[model samples]
Target: MAAGRLSFRNITALAPMVRVGTLPMRLLALDYGADLVYCEELIDLKMVQCQRVVNEVLETVDFIAPDDRVMFRTCMREKDRVVFQMGTADPDRALAVARLVEKDVAAIDVNMGCPKEYSTKGGMGVALLSDPDKIEAILKKLVTGVSIPVTCKIRILPSVEETVSLVQRIEKTGIAAIAVHGRFKEERPRHPVHCDYIQAVAGAVSIPVIANGGSLDLVRTHADVEEFRKATSASSVMLARAAMWNASVFRSQGLLPVETVMEEYLRYAVQYDNHAFNTKYCLCQMLRDKVESPLGKQVQAAQTNAEISEAYGLQEFYQQTQDRLQTKRDTLQRSSQPSCPVMDGDIITMAIKFERREYPPQITPKMFLLEWSRREKLEQPRYKTVQRSQDRAFQSTVTVAKKKYRSSLWEKSKKFAEQASAIVCLRVLGIPEGRLGEDDSGLVCKRKREGRSNGNSEEERGKKLHVEAEASEPAAPAEGEGPNHPTQLAGTL
Candidate 1:
């Protein structure tokens, strides 16, 4: 392997799970002992369009190095170990999108083995498996387009010879590695994974070959991985659901207790802001061994990440699990007692402690919880302040819109007044009246439309006209005849 490129030191890698394999999960795997880790498979086009997906899946450092690509996804700690996998059918599209993210990853992997309908329907994933020529072209384009090494992950074909031939053909395209999932495309989780075929493919390919599938059994995952490597003769072993159950499978020290692993994983979840579904799925997997426990039921029933976290109560749960394990250890340590090597519940923890007594003391559960709590507390106020700022900004926008509306209304009223005043001036300055008529009070003028007053109804207009006529005509005097002195003459008459 070249510098800054992928090197399988431990030969244990994390598989690209669609929802479950996130940045936090990769980080957890790295901490445990995975030599290489891949992020979830992203569709080339969708990955380019959806920044929310990027944010949800990838977590970068607080600040960036000068040469860092803005789309860089992983945190500072695991940048060198993370492989970005994309699903694409078109060579142009693959090359175009590959350039967008090549600088940030250790290597770029083409997802050639997804069996789901959604993936196949899009002419990507396992759909590419049917067309090796197209796959070769895609790999060629990607290798030429970006500086990073390109790899492809594929499922096995029916025959071992055909599978080996397929790997050999793909290796000719200059892919740095080939990740072979032992099952055929039509195979499901319930089916047994065929490691014999994976071994055949590994023997065929000169490039690094990674074996994936059926390595996620909870108790036997680590053992299963060892068996898988031995059986397949693979350069590396990739884990999907197994790492979710307990990331510690990568460590040679053996598996940690589920409670201990879950607590550490939750801390990573908070630290990385993993998607809720990812968090929930991991929680469910960890609680599998404790299915009869109330905590397991509570975790299953929880709808949100916060609720799940609360139900687990990391510190309290770890304390209880550790104490129970410790009690079991004390019980076993007694020489007088009948020597039973394995106790029932916390055998995993005992195995770990017995293998390496210095393990628990190195990073105790309390220490991890305390560190996570401090970080959470520091982040809370910052989050609250951001929320407050957003609220204030929203309120300000509404206020500005309201003011604009009021100003618009006022401007319209002012313009209407000016137009009305102009019409009145035209009438007063000897311009043609054109049937313009004022009301009796002279406060408002009614314009005539086709000889009918616009302001009043027909009956009211007739009444107003009659009143105007009576006012215009000379009024008949009272029965008395003359003006001033005639008053006396009228009285005499």
Candidate 2:
């Protein structure tokens, strides 16, 4: 490897998988002795729109989307060992994404091996294999444009000679390393990997060659990793399905039981505050054929991390992690307070952000506030929003029952800022914010009437209100529902 680049020499690594290569799985592979880990392949188009955020509560650096979804997350623990992989066909777009994340990752890997339609339809992934000139341009652009090591993962061509010629062309682009998945573009997992083709490419290229695609056939155990490396004559070995099924396959001693590995993975999932759906998906992949077992059925039915923890008998661990996260958030909130307590106009402001994970899925603070207003027969809330020119962060103030509320913290989008303001109002009014632990609070604001001529049940009404709140701005106050009406305020605790 060149100076300032990650070395791919004689090491075992976790391959970049579609959904299986998330933070929890990457951290687990590191814990079990993998030399380097790769995050899942992200499209360059999606990455360019993300805003990087330092999440103090989760203790990770998050690339958050405009809708507040986490596109990619990594903590300081894996700073030097995590490789970011992205799919792109354009040289400029690929360079833009590489520049965006070069400082945070150890290296950048262009994904050229994926055969999925989603990647190929966009002229990315395996589609790059058919365009050698475009591949050279993209790789060279990244290598010369970014400060980090640039690499590419590619599938073998139809023949060994063709594969060697392609890798030799890739080497001239000044990449630090190349990972060759020893299969043709049309080959599936059931087809045998062509180790001879990988070896030919390794021999042709002076740069380090990382061999991949030998999971179920040649590489089943920890010891098989070296066997696969020797067979392909490559600098290192990368595991996907083998590591997905059992991350401890990287352990030199022996592979641990699937159950033990699953339990340990859940611990990391909870500690990192991973999304419940992702955690469950990784667990199911580990289960494999055992997915038909009773425990598997229970895990399959789980909708939340807490439910998954109960299935794995790790509820206590889950609760402790949640409690620790809450405490960290509270401490950070206090630390963000201004010492002089300057007032914004006449209303006092406090720091707050709308953390989507704290509430149930598809539920927001704005939805709760809207339901409350309708229940009390008060006018709908109105919001005044503004976006900062320099950073594009938005701040909003929402009026409920003639009282205006706003958060000191600016959010990434107007919707999030409005939700933050609603949170402040909900807190001041002594109402539950409908967080996960609040009992029946989400249901309290629903209509009490059992029957309606319009045929909208309580659930239906709540869903309709949620849609209206999210899709449109707050409605204007009625003629008599102005601030001068002097309505009774909800009592504070």
Candidate 3:
């Protein structure tokens, strides 16, 4: 709201994603542009013993100056679901984290909105918002224990009056600032954000009260900031998916080095390359839009980042990369100018700029069948063992007669039935079922149903399934089928 550079040296803040945005990503922003980086929320118990969790929270980030602030949000291992945590209700535990804050972080935050069942069982987050005294005690101790500022992010409670009352109580505890997501903890992502409640909390709290919720598009980001300025007189609004949605949109308003912001992001994210496939896989996503650009097209042609890096002569690869992007400007300028062939001597009326045909996104019948199989959990016909198991679990509803009838056949018919069932489930799932596992050829499960009109053609898909079954069946090991490989249970089964 204040020209994209509102100073937060002492006032409140807006750290958009309360979860999922890894520490490395936050650290990158701290380097690129963030007043303070909040580490991914840490379960206080895990905080005490799990370095792995701590390391995960710390990955891919370094936005802090030697003297700048880092904030650690204390949380309960609500993922465990075995206990009810009353947030940082335990003053001693809250103080222990506050002490950690004293070491290197710029500040400390107490999480009151984790929405996890385990956290709820522990009586923390929205579950504990009802108990103001516990919230009060935790904040008081945390504030008293830490030397730097303390902040709170609340996923607006279901009850407006209750939230406002809680805000008043929260303010009494001396927290420096508070942010309220417009939706209740469980309702966001699916339900629309409710901005009015944020306005109420902002009005109720004397300290900087930031409003958060829907209208997070670029236009909405600015509008929310404007709204916050008008409603509660807060100076700025936080950007969540709004900024991340189009991470570069902030550049011109002084978000220079936009490309590097993304590059740094890649550095942080490249880890967790679980299958060694994710790094390239994710880079492809980041580059998807960039590739549509002129320079991006060239970068994508490199096939691999190493090639792109070699082409650009830079190790940190990004398409339409900052360094090489300039060369494209001239080409783009030339292309934008009208190109006339001067057909029949007169300037061809409208530079019939052959609009490149974009591939139309289409879903076919087999895909529809696969979706059905996933959603309806169709039975596997070839494997009676699997059909029986599905019947016991009630996961598949194929009639017992169908299962018995299919199983009575030999390889070809049985395989056809199983493929039919899988295709049916895939159709029910309607998207793609679980991502093609590692065995898939780059998961390219393209089913081209362009010419076939008759239902009879489905038999071909069944034939392919039969081939796969034959391939997977154990070949007699000279001595003949004594026992198949013990670890052979995985595949289409």
Candidate 4:
């Protein structure tokens, strides 16, 4: 192995299992004794459209989709040991994705062993295995374009000679390693893995070969990992079901009880703020046949992380982690504020953010501002939002009546930043943004009261009176209408 490059020699790795190779599980695998971890395979098309975001609250780097959902999340801890496995058939799209994530991961592995229809139909995964030319093209592109090591995982062909021939061609692309899952394209876990065929492929290729698909028959404990490695004559062994069942299988001492492993996994889940549903799914996978047990049933019924933690007797840990995250968020917010005054052509701005929890469900400040604009027969509000490159935070400015308003506080999403700007505009105009009691009175109505206070300067008082006089006439419902009777705005905001 070269300096700054990943080495697969004599290592135990976690195989990339869809929906099972998520963050919490990968962290657990590393906490045990696994040498490397592969994140779940993400499609190139979906990955290409995502914007990278640095999440200060969770201390993770997030790839956010257009819908504001996190497609992938990784922290600095796994930057050197994590393998970003991607599903792609096109050489250009594959290279594009490789370059996008090259800095955040140790290596990029192309997934070619998946036999599912979704992958094959898209000319990816097992589909690429049949088209050797496309596979070579994709691999060559990644090897030449990315600075990190490149690898691929594949299922063996029916004949050892054919698989060896294919791998020999793949080795010419200069990939650092290759993983051979000892099964044919149509074979499942129930079918026995062909260790002899894997040995043939490993023998033919000079690059490191990672042996996979041994969980069902060979791998169960730490010693089995070496046995599987020797059986296939590969440089490393990757375990899927065995590690998923009990990550501590990587422990040299022995396999620990599944219950103990699950508790440790939950701590990582809570610490990382993993989604409740993903945590539950991984726990259920650990439970397997025992899902009918009382603890499993309790976990299955949980809707939130707190509930899941309670089911595992980790509620105190969950609460402490949440409180710590809140404190970190507040600190980051304060540190992110501009040291100097913010000015847009001589207009000073105030810092703000749209807190969804502070408003009634389905009601937003943007909706209210748009309605107020229409009722007063003014131009519709227009928002210009930009994402900061340093931390991927979003800031938006909204223009109404030839005046611009913006929030200095950066938001996690563009939609939220736009709403924040709208809140600033509504507050300055003395318009009710939401109901007082149902919503957070301090945030929703604080500015409305400030606009009417005697502490305002004469110039500020004149501006407020002018705006209120313009909106006083009955062109529509009054500005102070409560949340129960908000003016309906057409179309989605």
Candidate 5:
């Protein structure tokens, strides 16, 4: 190759061979003497809205060393409101996002390759590929606005002619370089990769091309790269899971994997997870392909069979017995792979650093309040509305704490209610005015409904005298004094 770089299946490297990291795992951290480390490809617009989510991402990547050559990758996908409602797209949405993430990384990449429907709806991700003009506009805008190198990922179109056309069209846009995901997105699942598409696109465009997809392990990576080299006569390759899960693969000088590695893997998994089940799930995937390897040839390729059976002849369940936190089956069934992975040492360390621990997360009072409210008699507390159910209990707890702060007010209101009706009626009836005349005292009423007013007036006058006598009368005191002196009690008591 003129560039002096080695060739892999349709992927060409320009001399400086670099090791790259996969999505979520950055390339700069790996010690491949990489050209640069690019972050994952799914930093969506929603991330911009939620300061907490944005802060978490920043903290994870904030410590990027200068020599590490860190960079950010955001898929230039459609702005699906459903996907990004938590964070949405404003006219200055891209610029707003750029301001938040402090970058020491080499470049900021906008993704246009992701084909997820939610992404497309947002007018950002892979949908841009359908219109080169729009992508060029986006690229030009980003290039002008940002200070870093801007790059993009492309996919082969259904027709080779279209792929060539798209490449030639995008090539003129003046991006720093380009990479191609060889499969037509429609052929995502198990379709054969047409490596020639990469070659065609490379020839069509003058920029550097990075090849992606297909090779998952070193055994196959060697073969895949070998074919890739033969097919395109190009250099360099990109890997995801293999490079990330086993850092040794890049450093192994091509050694085949072993069961001992799996044992170490389990050790790390337990260490990182602290007995959580996620470690188990990852362990199962890592050991999935070993069945055909030398250590695995003795065993059958039974992915579903988690219990290493006598038929496969490999069972070292006792490895887990040493740790009280772990337990393993003496024998695995005739399954294809174990449900969970058990990892060891460096891999575990790498995971512990990159992957978050599955533990009881730190919570604030507000989270507890939300959880408590969810359990309230109200139709449904706000907990159901929150996407994160795990924090519901915490959020509701805070809700109740605030309620506690105001509970005294509620109790005081309840106590006053018993006398409220009588108080209100007395006020309404014009509280005693000065004299207790026949009418004002309620001993007589001028009722039109009565038989006769004059007759009632004369009867009232006579009744009034009796009413006064009764009002002036006093009963004997409780201890048998003839009567209490009203003059003394009213004046002094």
Candidate 6:
């Protein structure tokens, strides 16, 4: 039971959030005091197939430096602090991808916590929970194949005994650490986090156990962090959605307004030249609390990164928000302290109250976009048929009952729709689904081959480092039989 298993000195880290967690977000988290960060879950085979291509294609982009050759998802500022996570069912693919980015990252984390159907349907993510033997084999191969540390992230089971046993077995694989999301596969974000189970697992495992879920309270984050640390006694805590809302939550002081947070994030997005969809998604999350306000309505209706910038008023908004925040802070400080040097009569206890104001209700983005589209169709009768066709296609995709496939279609459609229109209409207009043209296959092939050259040298080094334990037969745990399947298909964290 060595204390050295945990690599980072500080306990706070950012969780791997799909799409929302980008390189800019990672760097921002590190800048604000997060000890470590993780890139979102990348599909193992897809990464192996396309890593070279993604790198090669993006190399010409000015923002991506030469040092980011191996791991384009990480930046120079936090290369040593970022870990790469992947979802995979195959041991070879897992090892291949782990070795692919070992030099660029702090460690490699296998995602066993994802409850989305796309992951489970492919026998990856939480599906491995049903077969612990497979989990051990995959992890063993990764540990033996790479020079850097290997770890895993997992969801809890129904019984504490089963959960504790699952972690103990993983510990024997010589993993550096394990992060336990304190919820069952069936539990959603709103469900109560099972801290008791996290505590049980932490007590059972000798390696560092990081506790996650339900501890990130956006309004009372500092208190929540302390509570989670005290309750689980785990090595550290992982902040997922809360950090997305406010990366400054990693900083100990100051309660930043939603507008300020959005402005800061926009600056990062500009510096990174993040994809439109990802940049827009982060804005949506940041404005979750302000969606009812006038500015919020315009922000939500934005389709492109440029529209988002315009809606936010960019630098003007940043300066105004900063002034407002400073004024509030100065007033609060004045109200809290005494004015006189000496006491006269008995001091009167004054209950200083701050005024709470809610933004006025405004037309939502959905309503505005829907109305705006109708007006355009009426004004331009000639373009009506084309608009109708696009709407029908989007409707068909949404009506389908397949949750996994629907989510996939929705994202693709949303990406295309946003590009065509000036506003992101996923939450607004049910737009048309974009079809893949004849050139898609060729595009895919080129992307797959992008990073192939660099992987060749690493593959040789990986083979030489493989341990004999990777060849042993690992038995599956007899405790859990059926797949610990997800309760629903709609979830991302």
Best by TM-score: 2
Best by lDDT: 2
If both were scored by TM-score, which would come out higher, candidate 2 or candidate 4?
2
lDDT of 3 by residue, 366-412 (tens): 23333343345653222221211100110111222142211111111
lDDT of 6 by residue, 80-184 (tens): 778889999999999988877776778899999999998999899889899999999999898888888888999999899999889999999988899999989
Question: Which portions of model 5 show Cα errors greater than 4 Å?
Answer: 1-38, 52-92, 102-104, 216-219, 222-230, 233-235, 241-247, 256-282, 289-493
The candidate with the higher TM-score, 3 or 5, is: 3
Could you tell me every candidate's TM-score relative to the true structure?
0.60, 0.75, 0.46, 0.74, 0.44, 0.60
Worst 10 residues of 5 by lDDT: 347-356
Ranking by TM-score: 2, 4, 1, 6, 3, 5
Model 1 clash pairs?
Answer: none
For each candidate in the order shown, give its overall lDDT on alpha carbons.
0.59, 0.83, 0.44, 0.82, 0.37, 0.60
lDDT of 5 by residue, 1-493 (tens): 1112211224322111112222122222233222344444434454454342221211222212222212222222211100110112232565455445524334445666656676667775567778777777766665566555555666678888998897776667655566666777665625565778877776776666666554532224334445554464334455544444443343425523544444544443322221223333334445566535653543333332223222233243323332322212111111322323222321110000001122111211122222233344322111100111111110000012122111100001111211121122222233321121213332223232132445656456445533543343232222222111111111000
Ten residues in a row with the worst lDDT in model 1? 390-399
Of the two candidates 5 and 6, the one with more favorable TM-score, higher being better, is 6
CA error at residue 271 for candidate 5, angstroms: 8.8
**What lDDT score is found at residue 109 in candidate 2?**
95
Q: Which residue pairs show backbone clashes in model 2?
A: none
lDDT by residue for model 1 (462-487), tens: 56654553343232232333221111
Clashing pairs in 4: none
Candidate 4 regions with alpha-carbon error over 4 angstroms? 1-4, 339-349, 352-493
Clashes of 6: 6
Give the per-residue Cα lDDT of candidate 6 at 23: 81
| lDDT of prediction 3 | 0.44
For candidate 4, lDDT tens digit of each residue in 307-348? 999999998999999778766875778687763436767444
Candidate 6 stretches greater than 4 Å from native: 1-10, 53-72, 216-219, 315-493
